[model samples]
Target: MQSYDVRRLSEIAYDADNGVTAELSVVVPLYNYADVVIEALNSVVEQDLTAVSAIVVDDASTDRGGEQAARFLAQHSERFATARVVRHHRNQGLSMARNSGIAWSSEPYLFMLDADNRLRSPALSRLLAALQCSGAAFGYSQLRWFGEEDGIGVADVWDPARLSTGNYIDAMALIRRDALLAAGGYATLADDHGWEDYDLWCRFAELGFDGVFLPELLCEYRVHGASMLRSRTNDHFDALMAEMRLRHPALLCSSVVGVNP
Candidate 1:
């Protein structure tokens, strides 16, 4: 996964001589996670699926995280049909990193993985099947709070009404790239530290795109003090919430129902 121009992504648009194109693309965004980026990518390349593409987005980290990711992807280059790494010259926030990956992906379905998190084996398979069978725009599975093995995060069934209150959708879910692009990839929040995932879910609900929930623990959410959401101070949260309200008041409703438009 050597770094490319970061602008060549096309959906299943690879050359015929390159054999079958990928069906799914996993975009990994990293920033100064040299110690954990390899493990994060390993979880992806180690998956059983073959028609998969992994895009490593090195978010202009001040560390060796990008180099480590490139080397690891290079070692496992043969595992996927197509894989590549794209590096940012300057530090763009997570939202930009993911939005760039979305722009550069050539697959119908996508999974946005953080450098510190990992996907469980067979989880992708299930999520893909759910999306295909239901003809939904995206699907997410239950998550396990890593280190809290005795406990699990059980996601409720699909409820568009509930989505308006708060975001229960973890960023690890598999989404249809088309729908994502249609609604707009992601919003750039103030200081680039907004609740991007929550904003995305709100937008999806607004678009009336079909969403599904699969009741299976398919990913692990690593808990640490340095996590993006955790690193923010209470003041940040208050400011972000106020901004969210100002930007998307309709999404903050409590009894919103029926996403069909």
Candidate 2:
């Protein structure tokens, strides 16, 4: 990572009127991951693409994550001239934090990033090209799960058509802001099955919003102890999948009440 001198918090907070239009808006909803938030922010900041805005929504983190992010913003004012930090008065779920970021962004394209994940420099350019050329509502690149490695080791590819049957695109995918808003954003359903991104993808299909998948790994998804999916037990995962199938009958080819081959 390139080192830059940190600026003052007040200086970073100053709002400037940049006449240039934003090509994309990156929204990261942060919880208590103070240790990793700066890395996530830097990934977006160092992107080669111009006219991109990074919006970090602090979901009322009780830990020092929020304070650390504010401090980083203070020193990196120029890097995030268009960037803004919004906070909730109380704790809201991840979906709510994402929705808040969407509401605040004015860019045409929106890229959702998990606070612990990092994106490669060309990832944004590649996804944007696919979205533009295919005329799809969104696009996703192959993901490389990161842990003890510095670069990509394995890749996950998805068929766009299969995604209609089951969610194949992760939350880090790039999506059109207008299409997302038209689908009514993320749904807050039963607490036991709060699969916000999956629900949103299903709605996108229903609304005839198209998407394409790029086969190259462009983002690094960190897997650690604090990972959300890791924290969920087997029963929790099963319950959530069951609820999802029940809620969206069209997505499942097999009987909702029975197991599939």
Best by TM-score: 1
lDDT of 2: 0.70
Put down candidate 1 lDDT per residue, 186-225, tens digits, no spaces: 7778845537877788778778887888888788877676
Q: Which runs in model 1 stand beyond 4 Å of their true positions? A: 1-19, 147-150, 254-261
Quote the RMSD, in angstroms, for model 1. 5.5
RMSD values, in order shown? 5.5, 7.1
Pairs that collide in candidate 1 are: 10-106
Number of residue pairs clashing in candidate 2, backbone atoms closer than 3 angstroms, sequence gap of 3 or more or interchain: 2
- Encode model 2's per-residue lDDT on 22-137: one tens digit a residue: 77988888889898999988888788787677777777787878667767766775665377777776677787777777776778899999789889888888899899998999
Look at candidate 1 and tell me the lDDT of residue 93.
Answer: 85
TM-score of each: 0.86, 0.83
Task: Give the clash count for model 1.
Answer: 1
Clashing pairs in 2: 6-75, 7-75
